[model samples]
Target: MKAPRVAVIGGGLGGLSAAALLARGGCAVTLFERSKHLGGRGQTSDVEGFRFNLGAHALYQGGAGMRVLGELGVKPAGGMPGAGSYLLSGGRLHTMPRGLVSLLTTDALGLPGKLELAKLLAGLGRVDLAPLANITTRDWVEQHLSNADARAFILALVRVMTYCADVDAMSAQSAVAQLQAKPAVLYVDGGWSTLVSELETRARDAGTRLELSARVSAVLLADTGARVRGVRLADGTEHAADAVVVAGGPGDIAALLPADALLAHDAARAVPVMAATLELGLSRLPRPDALFALGTDGPWYASVHSAVAKLAPEGGAMVHVMQYLGGRGPEASEARLEEVMDALQPGWRTSVVARRYRPSLLVSHWLPTAETGGLRGRPSVEVPHVPGLYRVGDWVGPEGLLAEASFASAESVARALVPGQQVASRRAVGR
Candidate 1:
């Protein structure tokens, strides 16, 4: 039997995962990446003995990403951040309430607010979130809680979890599902590049050809424009393939298939989630106790990731301060994030070993909104009217969020391409 040749675009997590899985499933796979480096947003940089991810990043313990990595036999080493965190409200930092003792002792919320919050938290697991897909987080909060402080606190938590500051536009169902997915997250050592390296190695070992710096100009289709024939590179080189998977943002996909109405429509509906971040490698943290803080009155987050992950040298600290942007100008957003740094680490400027400020960073390609039916509303893996053409990315799948969504979409594409073959059994047969 002739093996089906598959071409994967964008060498990020999703592309790499799909390439490896499909190759293992008796398909000839070739992955093309525009950049010299892989990982896309997952790439990490090192400066002055400190490793910095593009922004604050964590892996949900039981999410689709972890499951996919496990299936690929890749184990990432990291540590979970401690529960000791603070809430910034009214220009004051208060110990975040975690358990029963802290809930009673914390001054962040009043007695009534605390009781209401506790009750809400207790019942989060049992709540049927499927019906809440069309409800916004703001509406959900307003309808469920009367205490102002509790309402604000819950909104802040949702922002931190989903990294989307537009609570009025975000879907409550997606927010609640993310919150209920076990709050434990791992901060990877050596940053997310660890996962990238592992996936790349596996892809290569599985006989999948990876072409770096290969910019795909267009996804070539047959004369009828109904099926994928191959991909054309920027250099005018064309590679023939039986299938092509586009693993990138909506803009990338739309640009490739400019005449496709479905791609155009999906691109118009995509809402980007952006953030301003200031990452620093400090000589030492001035206020070590203020390791993690979330703003209750604003969209701000500060975390010392090096405390849990080995991202810095001995005694050095790596801090990431971010402000989830909600239609705010980049200049103002950057200033607000700097203010958060000032509050969390007083006199931090003096101890700065290295620093990078990104005014506008794309946190996610699409913000799961109420109008779109939350996560389930995203586009499917197969491209409509274009057989053998698929899409995989953070914004394409119905399951998971962020990197998890990327992995989930990639897994779906792999399963669709080769239905009955398992990764282990197929690999044993050898490419």
Candidate 2:
């Protein structure tokens, strides 16, 4: 008996993970990617001697992505910066409040503001975030703490964690859940593209055929719309498969299917957030004391990748400054990010060896919220309306952000494909 043939669309982490797992489980897998390279937005570009990623990517310790990597025996070599992160306020950089002592000692807030913040942090564990789902982060902050200082600090934290501002648009429940989860942050040693390469290798070693620059134009569905036969390529060629998994962005994937196709409605409704990233490769390091920093008053974040990862040439430094913007054009966002980077690393302009600016990158497919409404926003992996078809992506039904969410969807679909063999457990990886 021949093994079941599976077709995976998109070469991003979710698709790669599913392909690797299915292949490992004795399935004949073929993964199709439209781009010349794999990894989607998680890719790293080489300009001159500098290694710069599409954006700042930090794997949450013990999150779903790490678990998948662990299963493949791919250990990402690098740890968090020892000094952690700082917050910019009042024209000064202050130690971010990590604990009661830091909260009390930090000059970022006044005595009254500190007490209010402490109370809020203490009560965070007790709050039923589900109820706060409909509430915005701004609304939640206003209700909990009236002090402007406290509000600015908390809002900045939310932006840093979620990479989405407009607290009025952010789900309070989602914000609280993220804060409560508190996953460990880690920078991969050789950049995320290296991780993508490793995953590709694992899939190939397991006998999964990866086809790049193969644009899938459509998913072939049976007349009853109850089953997927395979996919049609842009070149008008059809490849048959027993099962099909789509890992593209929700909108892009939905466009491949007919209006009546399963999960199409949900996919169309997904709200994606845009990320603006400014990557600067310096001839020398700056702010070597800490690994991360956030602008409390401004919508910006900066991290020194070289301090934690081998993403730059020897003696050179790689820094990523990001701003999650709403409605702002890429050019405008880039200009704002440049200013933020300049502030974080004074005289960095003179030290610049190479630089790249990404005005717009879809960071999240479905905006996560604390409310029940946001829960059903993401479509599940299994397509009940269409058998032999599944979806896996950051926007798919999973309770995590970015890589974690992508892995969660991939793991769910893989487990469903091969339940008895015991695929990688969905455990968070941490130091």
Candidate 3:
């Protein structure tokens, strides 16, 4: 039989990952991206001599995505994890817990909060691995710490990082993994976009075909239920393929799916209101050393600047600040930063040589089932009775995250296709 032709829609990490893996598997893969470039919300912008990561306030090497990168031969960009954060309270900036010493005396949390957090973290770190698909981040955090302060700290951070406006909507299982994490958030020396750019290069070198500005409108299957016939593009062109993976957002998959198979899709709406407001300029220059400060402390504002020296002839350091505001309504979000900008630094607002903002998927419904959150009417693992189509998302991972969840979900789909030895030899692939 001829090798399958796989068409991956959406240029996000999940889609790119699927395409890369399928290509490595010897399948003829065609990746379609609607944007001019890959990397979904992962895009970074350079304005007036400044570079800014629009999403992901902070990321480190120890996350699921980092693990996947290691397997793919990518290394962390820079040195030790960037400086940590603190909560603002009573006009004084109070350091939040970053390690054993800080945890014992951090002012933002009480003794009870710290002890409970320690218990949860230690317990989760010790517990046997379980499938993460069935748990929500909220449940996990509550289970471990149960302290209002700790929960707020963790959930608010997740809200900003994951674009989750509805903090309570995340998975307990996913939450458990995050809170237990080691503090080694990593970024490429240049920026996170460079990582995606690297993946694209490596993938193409490995024989993957990338088609940007192209959107896959539909994943069509023949009546035989044995093979995926092809994908229908937005332009109405049909490209034939033997297999198809919906690595785009699960919602995108549910939309293209056939009516008969629609029931097979989960109706969980992830309510993550995400926003990234980046301001770039040579407004603040500091010594080429660790300079950490709270926007005022408290969970409300936190920031870090990776100084760029000799970056320009004048030698002014670049500043890229990331701000996340909960779903306070669009009008409110529009004014949040402006109102706070002057309060933080009086003259920097004018120094903002360039500013760009794009916020989407602000909210996504978590899975709607006891297995996921607490909702009903969820999709089955293999798409009900359908044969050629499969879904991958945070909800599908053995556990989910940028790297682990996406990788697990994609591998699960790949294995279900390759068949046999799934249990004896799980077809796990590092995302």
Candidate 4:
């Protein structure tokens, strides 16, 4: 049988993973990336001997990202953030109540609040999430926890876990699942670009032809408009393919399709999760003890990522401060993130060797809303009414969140394209 020719649009993790898997499954794969570089948001920048990811990037140990990377023979190495995290409330830092000891001793919450939070944490994993799929996180928190401090603390933690501030719109089931998953995460050494490099090497080794700087202008369809013929480049060049996988955000995919397509209409309605971030590379830390902090009074987070990853020089530091944007403007959000940095790392301005302030960053393509029924409500990999056309991205999957969802969606599309191929079993990849 002649091998099917597959053309992949976008060169992010999802696109690279799909291309590699398809090639390994006996398909001839060609991957197109619009930018001169691959890795989309996964790309990292190195300045003054400090490597910085686009924002704070972490791989959840229990999520699909690790599992898929393991199957792909890619092992990401980094250190886990220690348990000594702080909670900022009333302009003071308190030990974050994570385990039993902290729960009992931390002054972040009162005795009643601590006990209530402890009970909720203990029962979180065992809770029946199906019934809560349609419930918003705000509604769930309001109905379940009576202690104000406990309620505020859990909401803050949810923001850290989900990178979302819209609790009133976020699905409770999705938030709970994130909390229940293994709490450990890895800040990849050298930045997230390491993972991108690994995936790129694997894709090329598996016989995928990567075409960087190649822009896909549109998804070409047959005369009946029922099947994907291939893709047309921005320069008027066209390549034939048996299948095409668009691995990008909703808007990117929507722009390539006809305005009348249902997928395009749905994409227009999808809401993005956004954030404001400040990344700094410092010559030295002003307050080394203040390594991590999350705000209970607002949607803010600060972490010394270099402490857990090899992103800085021997004695230097790399800190990331972020504000999960709800309805705040870019200027306001950036100011809040700066305030968070000042509160967490005093005198950080003097030690900074490099600094970057991103007023707005698209953290995720879609916010899993209660109205949409959470993760299960996301679009399927297969494009309805269009055979041989597929979509893969963080917003087009039913499992995991963030990069995990991207990997999961890619695997799903690859399996659908090559039905007989078996994905490699997950291996024990070194951290």
* Model 3 Cα lDDT, one tens digit per residue, 248-289: 565677777646444333443443234445444554543233
For candidate 2, report its TM-score: 0.93
RMSD of 3: 5.0
How far off is residue 36 in model 3, in Å? 2.9
**Can you rank all candidates by lDDT, best first?**
1, 4, 2, 3
* Cα error of candidate 3 at position 53, Å: 2.6
> Tens digit of lDDT per residue, candidate 4, span 324-377?
887332333666777787878878889989999897898999998989988878
lDDT of 2 by residue, 1-431 (tens): 78988999999888998899889988899999999999997888887677887888888887777887888778888768646578875445788888899999998899999988888888887777556657777778899999988888888877777777757666776677677776678888878888899899999999999999999999898777668888999999999998999997777777777676545766656677777788888998665565567888877888898887788888888889988775322333777776666556666788889988877777888776433344434577887777898888887774677778888888888888877758665532110
Q: Each model's C-alpha lDDT?
A: 0.87, 0.79, 0.54, 0.87
Q: TM-scores, in order shown?
A: 0.95, 0.93, 0.77, 0.96
Q: What overall lDDT, based on C-alpha atoms, would model 4 receive against the true structure? A: 0.87
Clashing pairs in 1: none
lDDT of model 3, residue 80: 40
Angstrom error at residue 374, model 1: 1.0
Name model 1 segments beyond 4 Å from true.
Answer: 327-331, 423-431
**Residue-pair clashes per candidate:** 0, 10, 32, 0
User: What TM-score would candidate 3 get against the native?
Assistant: 0.77
Give lDDT tens digits, candidate 1, residues 98-124: 788998899999999999999888888
